[model samples]
Target chain A: MANGELKLLGTWCSQYVIRIRMMFELKGLSYDYIEENFANKSELLLKHNPVHKKVPVLIHRDRAICESLVILQYIDENWSGTGPPVLPANPYDRAMARFWAVYIDDKLPRQLIDTLKAATEEAKAEKIADIHAVLELLEGAFNKCSAGKVFFGGESVGYLDVTLGSYLAWIKAEERIVGAKLLDETKVPLLAEWEKSFLAADCAKKFLPSVERVEEYVRELLVTKWKVTSA
Target chain B: MANGELKLLGTWCSQYVIRIRMMFELKGLSYDYIEENFANKSELLLKHNPVHKKVPVLIHRDRAICESLVILQYIDENWSGTGPPVLPANPYDRAMARFWAVYIDDKLPRQLIDTLKAATEEAKAEKIADIHAVLELLEGAFNKCSAGKVFFGGESVGYLDVTLGSYLAWIKAEERIVGAKLLDETKVPLLAEWEKSFLAADCAKKFLPSVERVEEYVRELLVTKWKVTSA
Candidate 1:
């Protein structure tokens, strides 16, 4: 939005990268999108983010910022006067939004990773239980926040929505990969509905990959890298 | 600061709890400090933070906020006008601050944990090297931000300072416990000096455990819990 060039170093498969993409689309900002090869990372990506050396790095005005949530906050703050604010104005509500966003980014993803690595039936069962517990908690939070509203932002797609929405495609892919129905409509009806709304949103639809593509990538990942047979 | 009551659920040995304690002290707010027995967690903690069930929970007017960094941000936002701001006024700088704070809270501590669990000298060395690489990066950030300034907040001890400063005592105890110098003053001179200033600050001095006490606690933890011998 300012002087220097804006660029996003990202990959198509990353939910984190999708978070930034959605933010950029929502703000209607133009930037050069550099797709990083996940197997062999680009030197530019590593140079900008030497600490983590990962993708989804936002480079604006020669300064690099990593961590998807941090970048989201940056985008919102940088464009404060322009578009709809991703974070709420109220201090406590902002805090609650941040709390759930962190839950989505930091907490839930790790459990999903562990579930992917489950070796035996018992291990898979335990991981599934853990994942369900977290999802149930999130379902409750989603229902509470989005009650009588289209999204977590209430009448618009906001911070908490994007945070969890980025994972919708990956969640579907995981269901296929794990051969399990994770988000049953009867149990988590609200979240299931929110998932539908989130994916159907204009911002998400622009960047989110098809569920079929994500499933294919996940299948390849599990079969070749993790040595897990597709369930 | 506002109309309702402020209460902190914490424990003496926790660096996270120390963060909120220091924040409250810096803000000049009065709150009931509830020390939780680590062995037997109270029902209040479980009820408030049903997900994590951990310490450093901030309760204001009966609404609970868990996660130390989340609680810190909540305090800053809720008491925005009363104290010197914890986050910077500029958007990009705020993003940088959040990035480093997350690196300290999420990334560095886990590496340190792995170092502690290293069984052999070679493994410990590898972990130590990994830890140092991260510290060196942090050292570079601290020097860039604090160039001729008192704190990361330039004139005041703010969010990033507290985020990294909370671990000063733990770093010291870990050095003693591991029988290796973690923060080599020659390498991380700025961080070393910042650690001194942070510990000597009025807020930190009030809540920070003495080096002896922390060392004793770490020693007990190693011997009884982890079976790590004090070098």
Candidate 2:
């Protein structure tokens, strides 16, 4: 095969893609990027990830890992020999990190998908409400971890930050998509601050796709999804 | 206050409760069972888990661990420390395990919840069809693994097994609550066999509430929820 190092398989402008990128940059690990046009998925991606057949596939050596959260965990586990572990040292805090990951995953995904599908005002509100409810839970959890903390577990950015980092772009996009902001400074100050901290960090700033790209991708997705729904 | 060991805060026939029980039994850990009245949740559960206030809450040495999957991971990491990790050792295999966990969590929860909340025949069939789609995905995944043996990974009742162990009781209750049989051998043969293998395992058998008890609980939940929807 080709040069055997860390290669991330994902589309440009995807939040999930941004996540894996930010993790590598944060870990200071060098990697190769293979952006896929999901419309015409590559044979390598298809064969490597036969199950999900989805993008944001991370190929390390010969092993191909799918799922963004799974990929992040895999990155941390494989590279744990060096640098700050993405997961916390304490088991409970690690579990809480995973717990939030699962919560955002379970609760928001349907709402997020449907938000794009939503046409009517009521439908959009329902979708927004679903996202708000889960965000509220996240906010309350962060609130308990003490104020003015850079990370979720108080002081340092760990698994929670990495997990939440992927979604910040989408949260930013939602304000434009739905015409309402969920993470305003006054409303969810702590969470809003976490977002700023996450993006402001050097690693995230370096690897995360440009805002122009995120806006372009979200705009295209929303418009394309609406076209399919309307027809 | 009395026994400084383990405490489980859950409903009588919770799927989440059964999962934790399976892990505890697998590791032979002993604990106290404090069934929460979720409707009027206790102050202890509320205080311990201010974020979600959800079950099954595991209180270990008075520290609250909320969310069933998170609690399962914690138990495996802590108490079941000296065994084959519930997660796969290989990175790809671990991704596969987490893949199914995330899939079931994402695609199935809402439909399964609606299946429990179904009122009439029309609602029931639609929900059952939704449930079937998930079962089909599981069926295909399991069939691939079952070509050799049982479980999604073929041989062991591991993390994905426990991650899904929660659903065994919930689905059995769905059959009772909605007057439907969603996990039948005829429709989803692979999943049906998976269910049998899971149920027969000593760990699963120990944690599972009596089928009669789960039936009763589902009926009660449906009645309560049904009243609100109709009103």
Candidate 3:
């Protein structure tokens, strides 16, 4: 239905990029994915997203949309007729979906990274506590909002599923690199089950980066930039 | 039209709270505003926003929504029939509105705070330069998006207006505390003009905090917490 070329600029291992890709697959839309080199960014990436100059920029008919969650909303809204709507039809539910997505995107990712890059044992412990607190909150949110539902979207993988699902591989990678178990099944049983189902979903199976690749990237990052030896 | 009681919990000086108040006024919605004491927050505020423990939490029909942008979207969507839609109807335009709002909410506010808190003159100068670069980008965005229009929403004040307008008073206060003119007319004429029109609007004039009060708060913050006497 789209009249013009739809191009996506992203890195292979970025969770944000994975989000857009998964959304496209779920929506059954076709688009070209251009893998951007972080060391040497392309002119197209820079030209499209001059402000952030970051990845996961969606170019539709040459109109670029940056930020993953924003791109997801754009994709859903533009393709409302064809795809299962990423946001709920009800206003309140849409707000709730957005609220959870923001929590997953803004809060969880940074905390996970910080847990990995903690400078000292004390800091790591504190960061782990913070992560647990966040997880508990999300666990409650998911359990309360998603009762007997296959996904946060109900019946199928919704916006929240795509959002948190994008980070599944990274979370696993952090488990190996950080040597801390964040998503303990006992603590967050619902999320644990949801993660399993999410990964097994057709879209996730295709788009999610391999756990080994994510682990390697994390290990390399720690050694080269943070000057830490993987234990 | 609505059945439930609407209550807003906010601090006196927060720009975010002011955004909601302005929206309420523009929409002609009657709601109770409960001023939150930052030093000794009420149990209600804590309960509603457990994760953030922050202000500007809106209670509609006993459902609490936190985060300024999320609250704004909630308000807009719930009251779509009454007020001018905060987000444009077009999907692309909605994405644009959200993109700019994120930039204003996430990027600009923290940078401005950092510019104020910089200890050394050299660091302050660097922060000021960074702020200028951000302003130049915003200037271009506002000018391009708001061509021949009074606000970013086109005819009347829209989402971007509310997002940026909330910070208008705080920006004025920063000018006094930092003692370096940031939003000079020569540098950002469009924004300067928009600022005047925004503050003069009935909604803004009534809801926005006074420059004197914001300056006083900054003065107290520097003296008691930051340990810096104003230059």
Best-matching candidate per TM-score: 3
Model 3, first chain, TM-score of: 0.95
Better of 2 and 3 by lDDT: 3
lDDT of 1: 0.84
Q: Once superposed on the true structure, which residue ranges of model 1 sit more than 4 Å away at CA?
A: A1-4, B1-4
lDDT of 1 at A92: 74
Poorest 10 consecutive residues by lDDT, candidate 2 chain A: A222-231
Identify the runs in model 3 with alpha carbons over 4 angstroms from their true place: A1-4, A119-122, B1-4
Winner of 1 and 2 under TM-score = 1
Residue B7's lDDT within candidate 1 is: 79
Question: lDDT value for candidate 3?
Answer: 0.86
Q: What is the interface RMSD of candidate 3, in Å?
A: 0.9
TM-score of each: 0.95, 0.79, 0.96
Higher-ranked by DockQ: 2 or 3: 3
Model 1 Cα lDDT, one tens digit per residue, A1-231:
554499999999898999889988888888889999977999889889988899899999778989899999999999887788888887777888888888877677787778888988889889888878778888888776776787888888999988888888888888878888777677778888888888888989898899899988877877788787734
The sequence of per-residue lDDT tens digits that candidate 1 reaches over residues B54-138 is 9988888898888888888888888888778888888888888888888888767787777887888888888888878778888
| DockQ metric for all predictions | 0.79, 0.57, 0.80
